[model samples]
Target: MRKSSIYSVLFGTVIFTTITAALVSVSSNVAIAQILPISDRNKSENSISQVNVLFVNPSIGNDTKANGSESAPLKTITQALRVAKANTEIRLAKGTYSAEMGEEFPLIIKQGVSIQGDPGSQGKDIIIQGGGEYLSRYYGSKNIAIVGTGNAKLAGLTITNPTPRGYGLWIESDRPVVENNTFTGSTQDGVAVMGNAAPQIRNNNFYGNGANGITISGTSQAQIEQNTFQNTGFGINIAQNASPQIIANKISGNRTGIVVQASSSPVLRNNSIFSNKEDGLVVIAKAIPDLGNSSSPGGNQFSSNGRYDINAASATQQVSAYGNNLASNRIAGKVDLTATAAPVKPLSLLTRRTPTLLNSRLQRETVTPQPTVPNTDSQELNYVQIQPGTIEFTAPGAASQSSSLPALQPASTGNSALLPVPPDQIPASKTGSPYMLPPGLSQNPATIQPTPQTPPQITATTTQTGSRYRVIVEAVTPKQQELVKFIVSDAFQTNRAGKQVMQAGIFSDRNKAKNLVRQFKNNGLKAEVIME
Candidate 1:
C-alpha cells in the first residue's frame, strides 16, 4: 500500500503540500481528489429554492441592500451565492471579478445553481480571478478560484487562478454541466475532476495553463467532448482509476498532448491527438487506454510530434489501436496497429451537451430598460421573479412584471414571528403593480401608494446584521408550507396562520421593508430576505 499523510488544498485543513512532495505518492498529487465520506454523498436538502434568478453587476451592485434583481443587482458573486437557492441562475455581466472586487475565492457552487456569462462569444470579456484558502478533504489549505458541487452548471465565463499551483476549477459533485467557457492562466490545472463527479465538460477552450489543461482522477467518470486544449504542459492528464470518455476533442500545440499514468483507463474515439513539442500520447505507470479493440474500430487520429507519436516504451504494456490512423514508424512501443479489423457495430460518436440558459420551469425575462418577468406559472401561482439580465431566454413570451418581495423584520433571541401566505397562490394583477425601478433611484416605483397592513415579523436563528430581512415570497402546497412551523430564520420567520400572501414596494424612508411589504401586499405575493 502507498504511504500517505494529511495534506490540504482548502477542502478541510491548511498544511500546504508542494507539487514535488505530491509526486511522492499519486494520491497526494494536486490532481488527486479528496474522497468524500458516505454521509457527504447522501446529504439531504428538501426545500425547493424560492429564487429563480440572481444578477451580479460588479460595476454597480449592493452586497448590503440589493435584492439580487436585475435592476437592484448584487455587487459581488459571493453575495449572490450566499443568498442563492437550488435551481437559481446567477447571471454575471461583462467585467473583471477579483479580490479587488470583494469576491471571495473558491466560490462553492451550490446544487442546482448555475453561474453563467456570455456563452455566445465564449465569455470574451468575463474574467474571474484570484484565489482563496480552501480546506481540502485531504490536501489542506490550497488556493482555488471555484469549487463546483451538487449538479451545478458553469457556463459562458472565463476563469483563471494565478497563484502558484492553484487550480481554476475544482469539480467534486455528481452530474454537473461545464460548458462554453475558457480556462486560462491557472498554475496547476485549468479544470480538475476528482471524487465521483460525473461531469459533462464540453465546448470549452483550455489554454495556457501551467500544467495539464484538464486532469481527471479519483474515479471521476467525466465526459470530455469537443474542447480545444492548447499551450499547456500537458493538454490532458488521466491518472489513478479515472476512466473518462475522451471523444472528439482537439488536443494539439502543447508540451505534450495527452498523458495517462497510474492505472488510468480512458476510452478515446475520434480525437485529433497531434503536433506536440514532445510525444503526442504517453502511456505509462500501468495505464492502458482503450484506443480500440479488434471487434470495434477506434477512429482516433494521431500525427507528428518531436518524439514518437505514441510512447509506451518504459513500461510493460500492449495497447490496441485497431483502425486508428497513425504512422507505424513514429511509434516507440508495442501498439497493435491492425488497421483492417472487422467492425462489430457502428461507432457511436459523443454528442455535445447544452444547458438551457433559461429553462421554462424557471422565470423568463425580456430585454428593456428593466428586466421583464415571465407569465409562465398558472394564474393561481403567477408571481413575478428575477430573470436573466444579460442573456436572452427561449421560454415562451413573458410579461414585464418584476418581483420585489417585501420581507419581515427580524427579532432578537434567534426567534421571530411568521407571516404565512395561504396555499397554492394568489393570481397577480395584469399591470404588475410596483415594478422595481432602475438602479440609482431615490424612491423606487415612483408611483406606489401606501396601505395599512402591519408588516410581517421575521424569526431569527442567529443574530441579524447589515440590513437582513426574510420576506415570504412564493406560495407552495400546504404540506410543503408546513416547514415554516418548525424552521425559524434570522431573515425568515413563520407566523402567518396559513393564509395567502401579498407583493409590496416602497412606502417611505422610515420603514422601506415594511412599506414595500404593504405596497406589495396589493400585488398578492409574500416575500422573504436574509442578511449575512
Candidate 2:
C-alpha cells in the first residue's frame, strides 16, 4: 500500500511540472506579441514608403489612369480619396487643387488616412480651394471643404473660399491631427467640430473668415494650440456644452477674441488675446471657462480690446447664474461682472495669487492691478446711441428711396436723423402718409429736405458694443430667441418679438425673398416673406 501511494504522488508531481512548463511557454509568446512600443508602431504605420501611399499634383497628374505613384500621380484630391484605403498617405505637391473638376465636396478624409503637404516650404506650395457657390455658404447644402471622419491627419495645407456655414475643416466624431494648415476667406467657421471629436489642431493660421475661426460645439474636446487668428469674425466660439483646451494661441485682429456660450467649459491657458475688435473673452449663458489650473492659474495676456477684457454681462438680458474663473489673466481692461445674477467670489480665493505675466515677453514683474469696476455704460437694449449726426439707411436695390431707419434714430434729437431721400422715398403702403417714418420721426413727403452732415460718431449699446445686428429669418419662442440671438445672430437685427411663427429679412426683390423662404423650408426651418 505504501509503494502504491508513493507512485501516485510521483505521477501527480510529473503531471503538474509538465502543465506549468506549457503554460509558461504560451505566456512568453503572448508577452512578446504585446511588446510593440508606441513609437515603433507609429513609425511603421506612418512610413512614407508604405504601399498605400498616394501622390496628387494638380499641374502634372491625371485623374483617369494614374495609380497615385510619384511618376504617375493623381490629379484631384477627390480621386485620391475614392481609391485610397485605410492608413493611406496622400501627399500633395506644389499646386492649387480645387473640387470644381470633380463635384465631390465636403471632402471626407476617411479614418486612418493622412493627407500631407510640403511643410519645409511653408504650405505656400499646396492650396486646396472649395470654389462652388453651394459649397461656400456656411449654411449651404455643400459648404464644408473637408470633413475629417476620425484618426485622420492633415498637415501643411492651405484651404480657402468656403461660403456661409461652410467650414474650411469640419471635424465630426473624430480624433484627427490637423497641423500647420492655413484657412482663409471661409464664410463661416474655419474649423467646426461636433460630436465627441477631440482633434489636435496646432500651428494653424485662420484669416479673413466671415464667422468664428474655430467653433467647437456638441461635446467636442479639441486641443487647439499655438494657432493664430487674424481678421476673423471671432477667434473661437465654444458653445453647446463643449469643453476644449485652448492654449498658447495668438488671437488678434478679430471681432471677438473668444466667445464661450451655452454650457461650455473650455480650458484656456498661456494664450495672448489682444487687438480684438470686441472684448478679449465674452462669456455668456452658463459658460464657465476654466482659465487656470491648481498651481498658479492659467496666465493669459489680454490687451487692446475694444470693450472690457472679460464680459460676463450676457446674463443681464435674461438673469441666470454664470460662473467663470478669471483668476490669473493679465487683463488690460476690466472683468465686467455687474450683470451677473449672483455675486461672484473674488478670484483670490481660488488662486495662489501671482501677478506676473508668465507667458508675455514684454512684462515679467508682479504688478498689483487696479480695482475692477463694472461697465458704467447705459443699458439700452433696443438701440445703439450715436452722437448728434446723420444716419444712413439705403434700401437694398432702391437707392432713390434711401433713408435711415427712423426707429433707430434717437427720439431725443430731431437733428439726430438726417439721410438723403428722393421724392419717391415712401413705400406704397405709406403712400397716403408719405412722411411716415420709423416710430419717432415726422417729415412731409411733399417737401422732404436733404441735409449733408459729417459721418455719425457711432457708439455701441451696453449689450451690443460696437456691433450691428443683421436681419434673420427664423421661428423661435420668445425665450428661445435669446439662444438664437447669440448662436445665429446674423438672422435677426434686434431681439424683438415677431408677429407670426417666422420672421423674414429685408429684400428688395420678391423672387429672392421667395427663394430664400424656399431654401429655409428645404432646410427644415419655417420661413416666409413678411415685408414691412
Candidate 3:
C-alpha cells in the first residue's frame, strides 16, 4: 500500500509540471502577437523636412543659388516663391521692393506652408510698389497670392502703387486673413477679392483712387469691419451675387455711396453712410438688403444730400428699414413706390402654371377705383331752350352758366344787384360790354402769353478755402451739364461722404465760384474752372 501511494503522488506531480510548461508557452505566444511588426514601426518614425527661408537686406539682389540665411539670401520675391514648398516659411525683411513691370512675379504659396513677414522691430513697414503705368496690362500681374490649396496669413506690410489696371491686393485663394494694412492710390479697385475666397479683411484704410475703395464680388464670405472708405468713386461696392456682413464702416465722400445692387444680401449694421452725391444709401431694383433693428445699431443716416436722401423703388424684396434717420432732401425722403406683397399659394391644380396670379390679386386689392362715365339718360342736361319772350331766355339759362350763376329776375325790377357779375368776367363777344376772350383763347386755344420768370434765390451760403490763382480766359463758352457732373464727382471724392456732388450751376464769374473750388482742391479735390 505505501509503494502504491508514493507512485500516485509522483504521477500527480508530473501531471502538474506538464500543465505549467504548456501554459507558459501559450503566454509567450500571446505577448509576441500584441506587438507591431518592426518594419511598420520603422515606417511610422520617418520625419518630414521643414525649412525656413529668410529675406535679409543683402540677399534682396541675390538669386536662389545662395543659401537662404540672414548673411546670404535669395534676391527677388519671385525666386523665393518658386522654391517654397509645403511647410515652408519665406520671411521678408523690412524694405522697399519694386516689382518688375508686366512680369508675372506672383508669390504662389503651396498648401500647409506659411510665408510670414518678419515682425522685427520694424513691424509691417515692407512696401511693395509695382513699376508700371496705371492703364498698363502688367499693373497688378506682379502681386503676391496664396493660390495653392491651404491656409495663408498676410500680416504686417504696406502694399501700395500696384499697376493701374491691377488691384492693390487680389485674393482668390481660400481662407486668407489680411490684417493691419494700408491700400491706397490704385487706378482701379484698391483691394479686389474674387472666386469663393472668404477672407477676413479688417482694420484697413482705402483712400484716393480712380475707382472704388474696396470691391468684393463672387460668392465669397467676408467679415469687413472697422474699415474707412474715403475719396473714391464708390466707397464699397458689393455686387455680383456676393453676400457679406458689413458692420461699423465709415463710408463717405464717394460718388454713389454704398450701392447695394445685383442679387446681394448684405447684413448692413451700424454703418454711417452720409454725404454722397445722388443718395447717401442707394438700393437698386434687385438688392435684397437685410436692414432692421435686428441688424446693427445707430442705423444709416442720410443727411444734406443734393437729391433724394435714401432712394429705393420700394421695399418689396428682403429689404427692411428700422430706426434709420432720413433727413434733408430736395425731393421726397425716399423715391419710387411699387406695391409688393408676399408670394401667393397655389389654390388649384394649375396654380403653378400661373405663378404671377397671386401677385396680381394682391395688387388688385390695394389699387384705387377708377371713375365711370354717367349714362345719357342719367346725365344732367346743361342747356334748355326757353321761349323768346320768357324772362329766363332774356337773361340767360341757369343750366348754361357756372354753378355760381343766379336765377333770372322779372324785367320790371331793373336792379343791377339782382344780376350780379364777377369782377373778371369776360363777355361772349368783344363788341359787347366786358367782352370775354374768344373761344380760341378760352379752350385749347393759341397765343398763350409768357409768364414772368422768377430767378432762384440762393439763401444758404457755403465758404470753401483754397489758394487763389488767376489764369487768362481764352473763351467764355457756356458750361456743359457734363462739366457740372464731373465737378460734383470730384467733390464727392474729397469729402468724407465719398459721393458725387451735383453742381447747382456753373457761373461765368470765376471769382464767385473760386472759394468753393478752392475748398474742394485743398481737401484733395478734382474740379474744372471755365471762364464766363
Candidate 4:
C-alpha cells in the first residue's frame, strides 16, 4: 500500500460523488417545474397536525382546545372551520346550529379541502340564519368561497335562510362538485359560481326563493342538471359571461322558468318547464345560447300550451322547433310565424253566436217584474156600503160557471139593485121591468182611456267572442320547448272538455301571452301556464 494510491482512491470517490449530485439537482429542477406546489402547501407542513378535525357540534361556549371527536367535539362551525387545514375534511353532525343575525362564519378553504355533513348523523346540521344580515350589507360577499387555487367539494346538507343578498352556496375553486343538497328559502340566488371555476352542481331542490334558483356567473363553467325549482322567482339564471350546461331539470311556478342573460352560452337540454307564471324559458338581453337539434325521432313537438309555448327576443338566436306535437293551445290563430303574418280574420260566426245567447239569457233573468193588485177598495155612499175589491160574477147563476174579477173602478156609489128610480129618471119602457139603455150603447160601454207610455227601448249590443278566454303557453329556453309541448298537451286534455277549447302552438310575443294568462287565471281558470 502506498500513500499516492490512497490519495488517488479518495479523489476518485469525491469526483464520482460530485457528478451524482449534479444529476440529482437537474432531475429535481424538472420535477419542480412540472408539479408546482399548491398555493397552501407552500406553508410549513410540520406546524399542522396530520389528522383532520371532525366537529360534531361546535359551540362558542365549548372548549376550543378539545379535539374534534364524538366525546370532545369542537363547539361552533366557525371553530371547526378555523382549525381545518389544507386537504382536511371537517365532518359535521346533523343538528340545528344557530348563529346571531348578521354574524357570518367566514371560511377560507386553503386547498383541496372539503366541509361535509355526516350522513344520518344528528348535531352536524349547519344552519346559517339571522347572522346573514351582514351578507346583505356587503353585496357580492360570498357566504363560502373555495379560493385556494385547488379543487374542493361540498355535499349532503341543507343550506337555508340566507339574507337578501347572501348566496346559499358559492364556489370559486376549480373542478369542484356540489351535489346531493337541499337549498331552500334563499333571499338571493340559491347557488352562485364565479371566477374561472368549473364545477358540477346536481340533484338539488330549490323552492320558495326570492330570486333565481341557481345562478352561474363571472366566466364560470358549470354542469347543472337534475335539479328542481318550484315557487322561485326564476328557475335558473345564467349571467356575467358564464357558460353552463343545464340538463334534465324540472322547473315550474316561477316568474320566469329559465332565464339566460348577460352574454351567457349555456347548453340547456331535456328540462321540464311548465306552469310558470311567465315564459317557460327566456333568453333576454345579451344572452347567446346554442340550443342543439332535437334528439327525438320526429324532431320536436310544440303543442297544448295554456299560453304561447315558445318565445325568443333575439332574431339572431337560432331555435329548432321540431319533433313536437303542437295542439290544444288557447290562441286566436296559428302558433307559428307563417300564420301570424297573415291578415287577422274576425272570429268565426259560430263562435260569435255563443255570446249572444249568453247575453240574452242574462238579460231575461234580470228584467220583467211580476204583476201585483190591490186587496181592498173604498167608496162614498149615503149609507155605509161595502164594495168588495174582488167580485164573483156568474155566467148563468151556477157556481161551476163563476169567475172572479178585480174591481178596476169602484162599484157604483150605491147598491143600484136596492135603489128606487124616480119617475123623471125612469125611461119610457121601464114601467114594468128594469130600465135598459139603447142596444148599441148598452152591450159595451168604454171607460176612460189613459195615454200609453212609450215602451222602454231595449238596445242590445251585437255579441262577439273575442280573444278574452284564450291562453298561450310559452318556453323561454329552447331546451325546454319539447317538454313544454308535452305538458301543454296534457293540460289541454285535462282542462278542455265542453266549453273550453284547447289549442297549442308557438308564439313570438310570449310576454303578451303571459299577461293574457294572468287575466285568464283571474277569471277562475289557471293561467301563467308554462311547459318546460
TM-score of each: 0.55, 0.55, 0.47, 0.47
lDDT of 2: 0.53
Show model 4 residue runs off by greater than 4 Å: 1-49, 59-63, 101-103, 118-126, 130-149, 294-306, 314-316, 321-532
lDDT of each: 0.56, 0.53, 0.41, 0.41
If ranked by lDDT, best first, what sequence of candidates would result?
1, 2, 4, 3
Q: Clash totals for all models, in order? A: 47, 14, 19, 57
Off by over 4 Å in 2: 1-50, 100-103, 131-142, 293-296, 315-532
lDDT for model 4 comes to 0.41
Worst 10 residues of 4 by lDDT: 394-403
Q: Write the per-residue lDDT of candidate 2 for residues 262-363, one digit (tens) a residue.
A: 556666767888877556777754566656423325567777776556755542222221222333242322232232232222233123212242223213
Tens digit of per-residue lDDT, candidate 4, span 393-428: 111110111001111111111001100111121111
Poorest lDDT segment (10 consecutive residues) of candidate 2: 379-388
In candidate 1, position 532 carries an lDDT of 22
Position 116, candidate 2: lDDT: 95
